[model samples]
Target: MATFIPPGSSNDGADIDLLGKELGLSSGQLREQLNALYARLRLLLTTDELGAWRNESLALFRFSASSSAKATEEYFRVAPRVLDILPPHLFLKWVKRGKALCHDSPGIAAAYFRASPQALATLPERQFNVWLAMGPGLYKRNSESMELAAHFLDAAPALLQVLNLAQLERLLLFLNRLTETDCSLAIRCLDSAYRVFHALEDDERSLFLSIALALVRLKPMASVTFFKQGIDSLAGVTSTQRLRFLTLLAKIAAYNSRHALSFLTDCSHALSGMDRNLHPRLINQCETVLAISAIAGIEFLNNSPAVLASIGPAGLERWYREGLRILRKDEKDGLAYFRLEFPEDGTLERLLVRVELDHVRGVLLMYGEALGGSEIEIRSSDSLADWSLGTIDPGTPATDGTTIFLPSSIDRFDSAEENFTWYKVAVTHQSGHIEFGTFNFCFESKAALFSDSRQLLSADGHGLSDMDRFLGLFDDRRLAADIFSLVEDVRIDYLVQHRYAGIRSGYRFIVQESVWKRPSPVYLPLREAFLEIVIRFSLNGELPFVPEALRGPTDTALRLLQQLRSPEARVEDSAEVAIRLYDLASIIPNTRLPQRDWNAGGSEQARSNRVDTSYRTSDGGDVTIEPGAEVPYQAPTDVDFRGNSNPDMLNIQPTPKDGSDRGTLSPLSSDIGEVQLNSMMQGENLQSGQYTADL
Candidate 1:
């Protein structure tokens, strides 16, 4: 059970007064009497001899019931003194310990308050107000005590009402200091103050705004939210009164990029109407905004030309120059920025020129001027300007002509072996004249000088023979014919031979071929015959007699031969094949047969001359006969076989005269009248025999 004491009793007090009074007594005088008493109290408090001696006087109140009231009254009187003696930090600890131990004894608490109201009132107000103004220290000795003090401020209406503008300013300064010391505590303090300021009337709102601005200047991050709240709290303040708030916000904006954009966007109208008198400050703010935008790649100033212009020419130029510098410095993003800014067709060209790539071949091809006319003359070796031109009139012969002239330093002559030549020829028609605007010819080669045309052709002719040998066989008839035709039609004008040596030999021929027509068959069977002979020769190792030497060796010939000789070769015993051969022979009008009697007794001769002479003697059996045959017969008057009679056959017929009687004529002759028979068959037996063996 806990003992209860009146407000001014010793039993419920912390015994702080007893300890203070004992400090005035001599240690030798208290020692003998306090030893056993200190031991017992030490045993109860779980302390040793040192602490027991120090707390010896408080142990006296445990035995005397009247001492509780005295102890509580003394506690109130000494608490303020202890606060005054101790540092602001330790004073909070005393308050908490006193409250915990004496909480059950309300009489003791009332006695402490009634005995020293002035000290009680003054001490809490002094400590808490200082804490509120100066911010929380590094160590919070009694957080609960601090909280209790904060609550006390709410009940102290007189003190709050009496806090003048100067005191509030000091408090604001203290809070700023706290923000620098402890940011979290500064946030809490500002939060509490914000609530208090909002509860104030219009005049108090203005005062609070000033205080908030001061704190914002000192601790922008901590005070930013509170400052905004203060600005909102000013429901009746004019725009002019809000100038300082805007200024503080602008400072906050200047420090943080995100905050700057937000401030600019949220307070755009307010910012625009900002005092012209604060031009320097405003300009500083703009500089910060531009800087952030440049770094963050935020297009804050893009759509607002008015805002950009408001920054003035000098500021914008500085910004632009800095941005360009950044672009030039960063390798990857720099090029990207340049591309975005100056996206023109020839921008790359201009950039290359700046990098001194005017003489670079690739650059020249991409961006340089072209050569034109009969001769493109480069005057000097260094620059493009040192140049001249020569005429290239059409329809005129190009003999000994200067086709192109380049700088002597450029090595105008190039071998045709190492690399190919690329020429770009552009032509345009103006008025009645056809003008070749510009023609660029680029030759990549090894030779360094131009030779005479005749010599060049002679060298080239030898080179061609070498090529023909290397190619193994020049079987391209069309190519050969084309060369022959060219030689026949065009006159030799000029030539240049270029040579190079590497893995293999290389050469080229430049010939001027006059355009002409020749007698060429629209369709030629010679090509088919040539191809057939080529295929046969390739397959069989020998050509047909008709075109043995005409068709030469070629890949097509070889391939055709291989296919024919392969296992999968197609074999045909077709009647169509035979018929085709026969048709071919028939179409050949000059075809002749060998010297032999086809009608002789050879198998073919027998087949041709053997006639199917059938005698159907009213029986089904048929008999065939040869061409020459003889049989016994009588002749009629109309059948005159007298002069051409066969010796073996006898014709018995009397010629009848016009007056003679028809009865006198023989019946045999009349019966066989005008009978026409084969005489060669009559000489031989009527059966079967050969008649014309020699014929």
Candidate 2:
């Protein structure tokens, strides 16, 4: 049961006493009127909430209304719910403002009083009044719908969850700030704000508001042109990347409050015309450059999407991260380079080396189509941003059983061929999941290849998916899922390389790249070192550089993993390997290199030489390891071909009986068709003031 303690009142008797003193009512008459209010209010509030309502209720009596008692009895009915919703101070402040607003338009004063509590609850007190106070001022100037001006408050309730109280205040303040001189423009923004806020993520909402705030302070709009069209401009951005992209734009406004509003608006105008879903690493790396200067951030914003459309997320990320390093060293030089303000920045020449999305999109489409033997569109998993509002690794990919969603950029490797091969590995591994029936596990049936696995679940089980029963065998499911992924992916890679002789070079290159690029094993502790070896072996490396102390455990893990590569191996075989690896990893201490008496070597530098130089990052960039520092073994998020890596194990459903819906069908292409003409057209439209209209 939830405790419904409302703010500020001790009991019902204290309320009667306070109201009697304030209203000059005799004790008996006060009791009668207060009782009338209570009867109507009990449906909305608990006894405790009514207690908190006392002080704010008493404060509303401070307003000099003619029929104070009757109006309080009627309007205060809804106001009780406000007590349940707001702090006592905020509620009192809101009522006082609404009383002040009433004096402006007496004709609709009663309706304003009736609606004020809910409105104030939607936005913080100050902003709700800021927008509300404008209506009557407009009415005096003969503005239409002045009486309906407060309808903007109706949008408040829906927005409270999306934008917290502080953002709501800033949002309204920005509206008032922009429309202050013109009542007509102010009314348009007030009406459109709800729809705009509804369509945007909270971070995107703040960027629009912050830019508006900056712009209003700089130059008043000839009209609220940008305000009206800004939200529509963001439809091209991935929800995952929107907040960071928006936040960096906000920093530009913060750096130079006056001109950045126009600057960011101009940049957004350019961003509005791209094919955001393809070629693509859906990365937001260039945002860091914003801290260097607004010009740097804005310049990247203008140029990056098209560059990304051409090279994909990988090449763009490399360009941005490298530019940021320069930006950090000298602000002016970095700024000049990114803006193409100087020739030495090598901006044009570096782009020449970039691997275009067109180069690999076809190769991957063929790799996937060959494996699934169905036309599969290799979709960019950029939509994950919209699905979740929180942080997710961009490297992780998922299949809806039809489209194999892969990261857009393959810039993890330096050479274009190596990057293309990386794409082939990801697409083939995911297609393998659909090619094989990993999702079609049966809970109670005996294993086709391994014995006694069914005993892991209860004898009389409730309805659970086969995926659940299979994973239930392990205590540490995350570790089990990871091991299963490594083993299953290895199995799929073998099959892909075996069947497609054409992609053999690409497939072998990625596997060898995984080993060559991995952190040297000498830097890790005994157990982590062993696990790293396990990963290396799964990539088809033969016990490469295993330390003498861990060679025993590494060999044990190798024996189990090798069995999983057999043609007759089943999901049970992968599960057994996962269990053994879990047991072995459990005993291996999770010791950091700096720990006293480290086992890697007596001296720290010996262990540190093996530090991972090629650190995998979300933006398809790598972190360089400084000398004499040990890099911890961080696992990569591989595509789980078995569909066992998802955390929602209980909800896993059985695969469809009909093969028709087993995997999502895609037509022949996933190409990103972009041309410079599209941006040029939008640019011309923006400069023409085409969005502005007479109010």
Q: Which candidate is the best by TM-score?
A: 2
Query: Superposing every Cα of model 2 onto the true structure, what RMSD results?
Result: 18.1
lDDT (tens digit, per residue) of candidate 1 on 115-183: 233333444444544433221222233444333333333333333344544544554554545545554
Scored by lDDT, the top model is: 2
Worst 10 residues of 2 by lDDT: 676-685
Q: TM-scores of the models, in the given order?
A: 0.18, 0.44
lDDT of 1: 0.30
